[model samples]
Target chain A: MKMAWKEIKKSKAKFIILGSIVFLVSLLTFIISGLANGLSMDNAALIKDMPAGQFYMDENAKETYNLSKIDEDTEKHVHKEYPDAAAFSIQMGFVVDGNDDQHSVSFVTSTESDLFENVNDGEIILDRSMQEDGIQVGDKLTNNQYSGEFTVKGFVDQKKYSHTPVAFISMDNYKEMYRTNHMQLLFIPGQDKAETINGLEAFSNTAFLDTIPSYSAEQMSLNMIIWFLVIISGMLFAIFFYMMNVQKIGLYGILKAIGVKTRTLFGMMWSQMLLITAIALVLSVSFSHLFNRVAPDGMPFDLGLETTLQLSGLFIVIGFIGATLSGIQIKRVEPLQAIQQGEM
Target chain B: MTAFTVENVKKTFTNGEIEEQVLNGVNLALKEGEITALVGASGSGKSTLLTIAAGLQHASAGQVMFQGKNLTNMKQEEIRKVRAQDFGFVFQASHLVPFLTVEEQLLLMLDVSEKRMHKQEKKKRITSMLQLVEMEHRKDAYPSSLSGGEKQRVAIARAIIHEPKLLFADEPTASLDSKRSQDVMELIRELTKTLHITTLMVTHDEEMLPYADRIITMKDGLIV
Candidate 1:
């Protein structure tokens, strides 16, 4: 093991080149992974913020949340069965500010429950993102279909739906504007097994998120990119270590001739790999976390500690497998062949 | 005393569908504290026989007896144990680990042989061995910094550091000039004599014949 470190120290340039390559690849992976996670949060932070639970919709709505309308009877039954349940409806719409600027939003209305923001009639709470568009608390916002005006009451952080800021309005206000009395879904918090109710389809929080029109497709593409990067980094390790091991074959054979254990040779290779990867992962993790803090407001890039740790662990394991796979040559080395080949 | 013996050793190498017999019915005995040299032309199986006897490769048939143990029937790991603990090797090239210093090379050999000693004692032995090879001045030098003769001297130091009963030298001086070759040979002869270590060496240079206590010639894969 000391010999391994000494060799690495003696041949600094070779190992440094290997380390820098790993660092760059891993940094790119962490940055891209952060983007994927951030975009997912941006797309559906409204439902994502909700506690783990089950969502019930009309079985006849064909798995689309907007088209699903739970009957008043089913909503009442769910509320009776689970006191924590809330009935809510979301519709993509636009509000016209006092300046006549039209702003797109997802108007969400839910019955009185702790799970959602319940506002009084004619008062609206908007996602903080709308504030950036010049809408402020106490500002009177109007809708083309409503007979009355809405006064912005407050703003909440990260409340978004379908890539649009959300506006929380009372059920009566929602009914008056949309001309509907039926809620689109009934949510019951903390149900391990969703009991079947007549004419209602139950969805886990994750399953319900996927049923959103573009959520699955958007996430699938981003997730595919993340996985592709992970696999590419893995292959990079394999190919790099393979080349290193090939160059050391004669040295390995001579070591074997002098009676060095095959396992000892493998230990040397693994130690070098671990040292290089640990340094690379540390740099990338630090830089990625730093980027997480300093990224621009418009850019969604969240590299959390858990995600960083998982990716770092994966890199180490992949590096081990890669270096070991390349080291299969060490096992096949014959002392006589190396002797015949001369100096390494 | 016969410290090592080979009985009718045979070795055949297979390359795809073709077969080549490198050693055929070769027999020999090596005495303790004696230097026995195997001399032959290219393709005469001297090197092959030496490697087989050193447990570097397997023979197709026959027995390799060392101190009453039949090494031919031993498992690969068992043979490796014997190779590590009881045998020393010097190849044609210095084959010093390019990354290690002259002193560190011998330390590695001691490690490979698993010689149990205190750190201070091990350091002392390395110092003495380096002085024996006249490489104590270059103890801290990496192999690349050493000339061919100096590197070969380090290789010999590494071989004898563990005090093994047998030393196998395959063209140990093949890569050096006449003066350096004579110096290396004289060093090997002196070390084997002083340390009471038996030596089996392969050499093609007839001018180097005088250093060996006994010389065996090979032709067409058999001792002649």
Candidate 2:
């Protein structure tokens, strides 16, 4: 083992070249994995963290809660059963501020003094991202479709959902703007029997989030990108490692001729690859963190420990497979060829 | 006792549809403490015969017995082990592993042996062998940094470091000047006698013939 390590150290140049390639592939894999997780979180962060146990939707609602509607009478019936039901109206739309800068918004409606009364009357609570639009607390904005001005009350930390920033307002204001008294969703706290309440369909919060339009499509698209990166990176690593093994065929022959067993030679080759890959992974992850730290706002780069560990594990598996494929050529090299040459 | 015996060994090569016989019914025996010289022209089967005796190449027919162990019938792995433990080789080109230093090349031979020696013992053996070949001064130098003569000396040291019973040299002095060649042959002969190691050296240089106890000359793959 010591001799094998020494030999690897002596061939530092080749190891460096191989290590650099693996590092680049690992870095790309890490970034892609993070993006995939981040995209999913970005799509469902606000809803996932919302303080709701179950949601009530109309039976006619397709897969999306936005298209679902329950009248005030149905809402009253649900609250009668659950008693902790919070009726809210939600819609996807764009809002223009006093400076005419347009920002996508997910408009939610409830009472100014009840369920969401923390939101002031005739005022909308915007996402923190709206700060980029130069909107202040006293500024007024109008919905593109509703054509009514609303005051900006304050900002919250959570960003967009389905690419739209959330705006909280009173149920009366939301009904007046959309010209409807029906609520899009009823947020109920605690586990309650979700039986048919006045012919309205009630579902768990998990099920409700899945029904959001474009959820599956968004997730699938991001997952495809990540999967493609992993496959391509694995293939590239296998090819590079295989070619490096081919180049070292003569060295293997020499070692065999000198009475080194095939298993020991294999151990040497595997050790070389493992050393290179482990170092590459460490370097790439460190560099990725550096990139994240120096990146400007809204760069869409998110690195988490879970994603990093998962990617590292993936690279190690690929490295082993690649190294095995490369070392397969060892059996074909005859020891005689090392002495006489010209024989493969 | 005979260290190696080759009986009617034959080897042939096929280039496209044309067949060429490289070794034709060659028979030879090397005894325990004798230095035998294999002299022949370039196309003669001297190196081929040495390769067969070393068990590095298989004879197409007939038998090669190293201490009565038939190499022709042995498996490749078995042959490799025998060669590693019982036989040593010196090539025409001083083929030292380029990456290893002089001391490392010698230690590598000891490392591959099935009989495990302690680190201190192995180190002492390597140091003494390097001193024997007068290469202790350059023990840390890589092959690429050494002169042709120096590299050949290192190769000789690597071969004998394990103290094998038989050593085969193929034109060991092929790359050296006349004086260096003489010095190398003398060193090989002196070591063979002192260690009581059987040696078979192939060479086209008749000038080095005086150092050999016996000379077997060949032409057109036939011993003359």
- Candidate number with greatest lDDT: 1
Candidate 1 TM-score on chain B: 0.98
Residues B61-80 of candidate 1 have per-residue lDDT tens digits of 99999989988999877887
Estimate candidate 1's alpha-carbon lDDT, on a 0 to 1 scale.
Answer: 0.90
The C-alpha lDDT values of all candidates are 0.90, 0.78
TM value for model 1: 0.96
- Tens digit of lDDT per residue, candidate 2, span B1-224? 67778899898988999988988899898888999999988989888888888887888888998766899999988988887888777877777777788999898888777558888999898889988899999999988789989988888887778878888898889889999999899889878888888999999999999999899998888788
Positional deviation of residue A231's Cα in model 2 after best superposition, in angstroms: 4.8
Q: A1-344, model 1: which lDDT tens digit per residue?
A: 27899899889998999999889989988998898878878888899999998998889999887888888888888888888899999999999998899999999999889888999999999999999888889999999877899999999998988889899999999998888889999998989889889999999999999998888998888778777777776677778778877877888888887788899998998999999999999999899889889998788887788988898998899888888888888899887788888877
Each candidate's fnat:
0.63, 0.45
Could you list the iRMS of every candidate? 1.3, 3.6
- Once fitted onto the true fold, the runs of candidate 2 whose alpha carbons sit more than 4 angstroms away are A1-14, A47-65, A68-90, A94-103, A108-159, A167-247, A342-344, B15-21, B219-224
**CAPRI level of candidate 1:** medium
Q: In candidate 1 chain A, where is summed lDDT lowest over 10 consecutive residues?
A: A225-234
